[model samples]
Each structure stands twice: as C-alpha cells, then as structure tokens.
Target chain A: MTKKLNVAVVGATGAVGSKMMEKLVERNFPIETIKFLASARSAGKTIEFNGTQYKIEEATPESFEGVDVALFSAGGSVSEVLAPEAAKRGAIVIDNTSHFRMDPEVPLVVPEVNRHVLKTIPKGIIANPNCSTIQMVAALQPIREKFGLTKIIVSTYQAVSGSGIAAIEELREQSAQWEAGKNVEANVLPVKSDVKHYPIARNVIPQIDKFTDNGFTYEEMKMINETKKIMEAPGMKVAATCVRVPVVSGHSESVYIEVEQETTVQEIFEVLKAAPGITLQDDITQQLYPMPIFAENEEATFVGRIRQDLDNKKGFHLWIVSDNLLKGAALNSIQIAEALLEDNIL
Target chain B: MTKKLNVAVVGATGAVGSKMMEKLVERNFPIETIKFLASARSAGKTIEFNGTQYKIEEATPESFEGVDVALFSAGGSVSEVLAPEAAKRGAIVIDNTSHFRMDPEVPLVVPEVNRHVLKTIPKGIIANPNCSTIQMVAALQPIREKFGLTKIIVSTYQAVSGSGIAAIEELREQSAQWEAGKNVEANVLPVKSDVKHYPIARNVIPQIDKFTDNGFTYEEMKMINETKKIMEAPGMKVAATCVRVPVVSGHSESVYIEVEQETTVQEIFEVLKAAPGITLQDDITQQLYPMPIFAENEEATFVGRIRQDLDNKKGFHLWIVSDNLLKGAALNSIQIAEALLEDNIL
Candidate 1:
C-alpha cells in the first residue's frame, strides 16, 4: 500500500487556484486528505472534493502544520506575506507567484525541464515559472535539447483569463455592450486598470504588464528572465512581445528561433512529433495547426506551424499554443508536486 | 480659386475604399468630380459620401480618363492589372497594394515623411505605403527628422479588417457562436478561403498573409520594405511580426526604435506632438491611449504609451494604433491627393 499525502491549497477560490484543485483531482493524486484555504472573506466558503464537502479555511502558518505540500496562487503580495509563513510549518511550498521566482534561495522548477534541480531545492519553498514562460519552456525544452538553441523571438497573443476573473468579466461585459452599440467601458484587460480602459473584445492591446524602466513590460521581461532561469541558459538571447488579446483562456505565441545545429523543417517536425507532453498538429497541407479551442482543457502544450526561417537557414519559426491557466500555471505546478511525490521528496 | 481635380476611388466597396471616399469628402478634397469603381460583382452598388450617394462603376482603362487621381485598394492582383491601365490613361495612380510600391519607377508615398518625393511621381503612378507602415512612418518621420533613426523593430497587432470584408464577417459570426455556447465554424479570417478555418473568437492567428519563401508573411515583408521606401533609407534595419487578432478595425503596433542622435522621451513626445496628421494620446497615468474604437472615424495616426527603452539610452518604445482602413490605406491616399492639390501639382 502507498502512503497518501496531505495537501493544502491557498487561494483556492481564485482562477488558477481553482484550476489547480481540479487538476489535482483529475490527475488522481494519492491525497489522503485535502485542505482548501482562501482570504478571510472566503474562509467560510465550502467546496467539494472527492465526493465530500470541504470548508475553505483562512491560510496561515498554522494551516500547514501537518501538511506535506502547500500550493500558493493568491497574488504576489499575498504570497510575499503567507509563503514564508506556510514554509515555516514544515510543509514544502510550491509558490505560483513572482514573489520568489527570481530569488536565489528558491528554486524555480518546471518538472519536465528542471526536475533534477529539485534535489537542490533550497529550504522548503519552490517557485513555479510564470504562466507564459512555463508553457513556452515546456514546448521548447525538448527542441532545445535535441537541436541546441541559440536565439528566440516570440510574440504572444495572450488571453484575458491570464489576468484574472475580473478580466474575464470585463471582457464579457464590454463585449455585450459593444454588440448593443453602447460604449463599452473597459477597466481591465490590456493591463489591470490601464490609466484609460481600452476595449479588448475585438482588439489586441500591445502593452501587457506595465513597462519596466528598461522598456519591457514586467510580463515581457519575466518571459525573458524566466526562460533563462528555466532553461538554465543565461547566455541565450530571447526577445519577446507580449500582447493581450480577446482570448478567454489560452495563449498563442508565434516563436521564431535560430539554433546552432543544422536542421530542416521536416527534421524539426519529426523531433516535436515525439516530444513528451507535447502534441504536434502541424499539417499545413490540410490547414491543420494547434488552436486555442482544442487546447482549452488540455494539459499538454501544442506546437504547430513549424517551419524554417526564410532568410536564416539556421533559424526556425514555430507557433506554440497552450491553455495559459493549465499548462501555463496550474497544471505545471501540479506536475511539479507530482514530481516531488515521484522522487519521494515530499 | 483652387482648380478642382477629378478623382476616382477604385475598389470603392471595400473597407479601405469606402474610407477613402469619406476622407476625401471630410477633408473637402478639391474634387471637380468623383468616380467610384469596383469589381463586376459590386459595380452597380452605391455608397453615401458626405450625405450624397454615388453609384459604383466597373473598373476599366476608360474609367481613369480625365481623372486627375486614382486610388487603388482592390488588392495587389487587381492593382497589378488595373493600375497601369489607369496610369496609362493619364491618371496619377496612388496604389494601396504591394503591386507597385517597390517598382523602380513607382514612388512609395507617405506625405508627412516623403511628400517631397511626389515631385518625381514618374509613370503617373504613386504607391501608397502599407497601412501599418503608413501610420508607423507618420509617427516616426517626426522623430527621424528630429533625431535620425538607425534601427527599428516592430511587432504588429493587426486588425482582421485588413484582410477584407469576409474576415470581419467571420469574426462576428464565430464570436456569436462562441458566446452562444456553440462550436465556432470559421470559414474566413486567419486568411480567407484557406483550406482549414480555426476559431479566432479568442485566439490569435500569427499568419497574417501567406508565408513567403523567406518565412516572413507577405504582410510583414511589406511593412519592412515599404518603411524603407517611404523613409528613403533603404538601409534602415527593420524587422516586423504581423499578427491577426479578433480586432475589427484598428491595427496596433509595438514599435521599438533607436535613433542616431541623443534623445529622451520628452524630446520624442514633443516632436510627435507637432507632427502633421498625428495625434499623441499617450498618458500612461490617465490610461489614455490610441485605441481602435475611439480611432474608428478619425484620420490622424494616434501614437501613445511612449517610453524610453531601458537597455538603450538612444532607443524608444511606443504603442502606435490607427484605423487600418483610414490612416493605413484610404486616408493616407486621400492625404497624398490633398498634398498634390495643395502643391498645385494636380
């Protein structure tokens, strides 16, 4: 008989947090018991798991007393305050926030790419890569390993869902207004409360996160920095344009890359065809490619529209799409936890 | 008194063509007479301009006779065949297609930047710059004149309307399906009449036009090539990513540029503020930006979200949004005609 683990999920009512819980149950993890936690306002709420009712608790250090794993996804500020508290209670923390991703002490883990780094997981908290970077690295790691990557240029068409539940509501409300010929008031999407709201129903807002002093948005810069951290290739050149689209759930990226080794489109196609946790749907002759609707509830990253760069023979262009909430955040975090159990580290 | 010029709008039924007529009327173009032309399918239709209705005529060589200006937006192939016929009939053709933009004898015109080149509109044919490029150059010309540009990297969030009427219809119908909880049936967009259709309701399709042998979409290459011609800096380094979003009208671009001279965000802002046919709406604190909805009926190219690039002191990043049908195509063409009339060259 296998020993079942006790798991705690903080921010269980939020978008990614709820998805995390769903994926946990979907993956059939050996959970002897589970605890759902949220803010003070949501503490009294009850959610069902495994055909039983579970009350949502207010997350605190005391909440993780005997828990073997704790998942955090409230927000950066919330994680900043509670993550350390949760870790202090002897539970291993899988943080899904930017609070500790770049921290030297916290290991940023994407189970497929850097599971080995788990042995060096410093202390008790482990960082999950950003939603965008996780999906990108997941799709690229196999290619990177087989072909040896040199440069990456990616333009993202991100869904509003990546922002939050508020963004989804904003999109729905504004879209309804737009159809009614009423002025759609926008307060979300493009960026949380851009100084002036712009309609995202039928438009792509180029600015994702606020621009950092260096001109890249915190979101764009995260992809650049996180990709380096996740791929463990600090010297690799990565340029990204993160644009928020009307998408509700998935993120689609048009990625152009140059690799060191000689490779053809067909050869690269063959490699992605067999890549783990990746689906290759590139059949241009039949007008088939990875799409968000099909990728909606799937955990695997979808890669399609693979071709070699026209001018640079060493370069390649590939379209990568994934459910930002799933593979991007929730699913990836859950996978890391599974990896922990697999290695008997939890 | 100013001499009125005879004008003809080829492809008058189109998104861009309709705007050209409206722009012509709004600007009070000195037109002795206006001729609306389209393909045989739409030849007999009528469109209202300035509260007056005009009948659409079938385009032919005879249609350009006695016409001082001919604005062509039917498409590249249409212009390829009809533009020369119009030019041969002594009409100064301002083609909005890629058909003649790069021809040795055809001058690519963006009046704000390269109006001086109009003096040498040889072969009686002038090529209007690509819509995305037209607005970008409108904004950049002032900066380049003040600071001298060296390098440019742009990623475009292009509107579906750029593809034509069918795409707008597809977006509407597909969105209706998604909202109603039905499977979206896509028959257009992501390129019309392509073998397979994917839902653009909440997805971003990276391929804007058919891919050229060199990997870049034809749309991207046009932005690059046209920017060079209009700026008269054939050596200017420009890379572009042209993506089709769910947008119905406005094309937004994330532009990163480096200039040769020392400059700051304030300097760039000041220069653009004074530039012709350009409106600066960048107030990050107020969340004011150049969005498609507000830009719907406007003629000016709207530039906003301007900031200095962090990595390079000489580089600047901006969000450039404009109605692709207006500033990008029709309005720019009309402006060129207006410039011609103002110069007494008509």
Candidate 2:
C-alpha cells in the first residue's frame, strides 16, 4: 500500500497556484490531508479541490506545523521568508520561485532530467526550474545523454500566461480591444513592475524580465544558469533569447544545438521517441507539429520540426512546445513532491 | 536631372504590386509613363495611383510593347513567362517572384547590399530576394564588410501579410471570433494551399511556405540560399527557421552570427549606426528595442537587443525588424529600379 502524505499548496489563488490545485487533483497525487495557503488578504477565500471546498489560510511560519510536503509558487519574496521556516518544521519544500534556485544548497530540478538530486535535500528544499527552462531541459536531456550536447542556441516564443494571471487578462482584454477597432491599452505586460509596458496583443516583445548587468534579461539568465545546474554540465554552452508572444498558454521554442558525437537526424528522432515525458510530433508530410493552442492543457513536452544544419552535420534544429502552466510550473512542482514520496525521502 | 522612364506595374491589383504603386509615389521615382497590369480576372478594373486612375490591363507578352522598365510582383508562373518576354522586348524586368531568384544567370539583388550585381543582367532580368532575406542581408552587409561573417543561424517571427492579403483577412476574422468566444476557424494561414491551416490571431506557426526535401521549409531555404547570393559569399554558412506570428506587416528575426574578427557589442552598434538603411534601437537602459508593431509602415530595417554570446567571444546575437511590404518587397523593388537607372543599366 502507498503512504498518503499531507500536502500544503502555497499561493493557492494565483495563476500558477490555481493550476497547481487542478494538477494535484488530476494527477491523483497521494494526499491524506490538504490545505490551501495564500497571503493574509486571501485568507478567508474558499477554493474547491477534488470536489471539496477548503478554506484558505494565511501562510505564516506556523502554517507548516503538520505539513509533510509544501509546494511554493507564491513569488520569490514569499518563498524567501517561509520556505526555510517550512523546512525547519520538518516539511520538504519544493520552491517554484527564483529565490533559492541559484543557491548552491538548493537543488534546481526538472524531475525527469535530475531527480537523483532529490536524494539529499540539504536545506530540506528542492527548486523547480523556470517555465522556459523546464520544457527545454526536459526535451534536451534525453538527446544530450544520447548524442552528447555541447552547445545550444535557443530563441523562445513564450506565452503571456508565464507572467501570471494579470498578463493573461491583459492579453484577453487587449485582444478584445483590437477586434473593436479601438486603440489597445497596455498596463501589465513584458513585466508589470517595469517602467515601460508594450501592448502584446498584436506584438512580440523581446524583453521578459528586467535587464541584468550583462545585457541579458533575468528570464534569459535563468534559462542559461539553471540548465547548466540541472544538467550538471558546468561547461555546457547555452544561449537564450526570450520573447513574449500573444499566446495565452503554451511556450514555444526554436532551438539550435550542436552535439559532440557524430549523429544523424534519424538517431536524434529515435532517442526522443524512446524518452519519457516527450511526445515526438515531427511528421512533415502531414504538417503535424506542436502548436500553442493544441498544447494548452497537455502534460507532455511536445517537440517537432527537427532538421539538420545544411553545412554542419553535428548541428540540429528543433521546435519545442509545452503548456507553461502545466509542465512548466504547477505540475512540475507536484511531480517533485511525488518523486520525494517515491524515493522514500518523505 | 535623372531621365524619366516608362514603367509598368505587373500584378498591380495584388498586395505587393499595390504597395509597389504606393512606394513609387512615396519615394517619388522618376516616372515618364506608368501602366498597371494584372490577370484577366482583375483586368478592366481601375486603380487610383498618386491621385490618378489607371485601367488595369491583362498581362500578356504583348503588354510590354513600349515599356522601358517593368516591375513584376505576380505569382511565379506569371513571372516565369512574362519576365523573360518583357526582358526580350528590351524592357528591364525586375521580378519579385521566386521564379528567378536562384537562376544562375539572373542576378538576385538587395540594393543596399549588392547594387553592383545589377551591372550585368545576363538574362536581362533581375530577381528581388525573398522578403525575409532582404532585411537580414541588408543589416548584416556592413557588419560582414567590417568583421567578416563566417556563420549565421536565424529564427524568424514573420507577419501574416507576407502570405498576401487573404491571410491578413483571416487573422482579423479569427481575432473577432476569439473575442466573441466562438470557435476560431483557420483557412488561409501557415500556407493557403497546404493541407493544414492553423489559427494565427493569437498563435504562431513555425512553417512558412511548403516543406522541401531535407526537412527545411522552402521559406527557410530561401533565407539561406538568397543570403549567400545577395551577399556574394558562396561559402558563408547559414541556417534559418522561419515562423509566422500574428502581426500583419512587419517581420522580425532573432539572428546569431559568428565573425572571423573579434568584435564587441559596442563596435557592432557603431557599425550599425553608420550603416545605410538601418536604425539602431538598442538601448537597454531606455527599454528600447525593435518590435513588429512599432516597425510597421517603416522604411528602415530596425536592429537592436544586441548581445555577445556568454561563452563564444566571436558569436553575437541581434534582433532585426522591418516592414515586410515595404523594405522587404515594394520599396526594395523600387530601390532596385533606381539603382539600375543610376548605374546606366536601364
């Protein structure tokens, strides 16, 4: 018989947090007792999960008293204050924020790629990779292992929902305004906290997060730094150019990779076909490939449009798509909790 | 004063041909006499150009009787027949279709990059490079002249207008349907004649044109082959992945290049600043970068978001955008006509 664990979902009312609730039920995660935690403002709210209504509680240090596993998606600030507290209370923390991802102690993980890191939870915390990073690494890991990846150059066509619910609402409202022949307004896109906002309804913005000192956005850096950490290839060369499209759910990527070992396009296809958590969608004759609308609610990371470079036999190109809310966030966090239970860590 | 010449606009009722009329007037091309030519279906219709109305004539070989310079924007079949016929009749034919782009005897031209190629038109015909290739080679020419480009990998975010006006109408209708909470239909996007059609109002399609053998789409191959021809570098290694986004006019590209000489991002900025027909909009502190919505109806190719590769010192990444209808098509054709006149080839 399987053991049922107590699970606490932090930031249960936000975009990713709400999706976490849906995924937890859909995946039939082993749960004995469930609690929804949010900021004090949303404490009195009631959320229904698995056909049962649960009253939201304000997340404080004391909320982790009886929790066996806690999933944190409440921004970085929330995780910074409460993750360690939850850990101190003997609960395993799977943080979805960027706060502890780069910390040497916290294991930045994509469960399929690096679940072994869950063996030793030094800080009693595991970090979920970024939405863009999760899908790419998950698709690339199998290829990397088979062909030996040396370099990656990726350009992302990210959906607006990766920024959260307000950005999704902005896209919907701006899309409506475009249809009405009115001037589309922008209040919350390309980072709500940034001083300048661009209308993403009929446009594509290149900046995702705020610019760092090295001329890359924070979002780009997360993909670069986290991929190296999760893949445990410190010398692997990764470059990312992240852009926000008007899509509401799935994030798509055009990835170019150069492998160390000599490989053919057929070999790459065979490896991806046998890999876990990937659906190979590359049939050019039928015009079958992954698109954001089709990938909206799917769990698998979909990849297609694989082609070899005309000049260099070692170089290959691919298009990868996945639902940013599912494989990219909430479901990934829940999977980490499952991995913990499967590994006998909790 | 420059000599005015008789000019015929073929496919004048179509998208690019209509824009050719506007661009000729906007740039004030030296015109002695102008005539509009179209298929039998559009013949006898009148189009107003520069406040003057001209009757559209059915395009036959006989239509080029006294024309001195003919601009062909019709489909490839029309160009394949009419271009050589017009050229044989002593009219300089500048063809916009893909019929003659890769013809060894026909010079593929982007005026800013390779105006010298106009000196000798062996077939008495000049081919306008593909829309996506025109803007990229124009921006890269000066950089290549200074630093010597060795390799290029590009992924494009193209607009619906590149597929002609019907695809544009479909996107608008789909936007309205999305706003009404109705099932959005797809009829003319990705490729109108292809077996599958996908929604583009809030989606991005990775395939443009049809797929060729070796798995690269014809659009991708055009970008690869045309760049080598226009830049006159047969050995330049290039790969492209073209995708269609929701925008209606401008085409944007995320381009990565490796140069033989060492260069800094600041030096590349300086080269772009001094280059012709390019606007450098890459100030990170000001949150300024080129976007398709802002680049619509603009004449200059906008380049920004320049960054050096974190690992390879010689590799650099850039974002390039331009109005596909203008610089990528009509304006470039008009510029080629002007170059021919200036070089005494017409």
Per-prediction RMSD in angstroms? 2.9, 1.0
The residue pairs that clash in candidate 2, if any, are none
TM-score of chain A of 1: 0.97
Model 1 C-alpha lDDT versus the unseen true structure: 0.82
TM-score per candidate for chain A alone? 0.97, 0.99
The residue-level lDDT of candidate 2 at A141 comes to 95
Q: Report the number of the highest-TM-score candidate.
A: 2
Candidate 1: deviation at residue A6, Å?
Answer: 0.7
DockQ, Cα level, model 1 = 0.40
Model 2, residue B140: displacement in angstroms? 0.6
Q: Name the runs in model 2 displaced over 4 angstroms.
A: none
Q: What is the C-alpha lDDT profile of model 2 across A177-255, one tens digit per residue?
A: 8778899999998989999999998899999999998899999999999999999998999999999998889999999
Clashing pairs in 1: A195-B286, A195-B287, A196-B287, A202-B247, A214-B310, A310-B214
Candidate 2's error at A90, in angstroms? 1.2
Give the winner by lDDT.
2
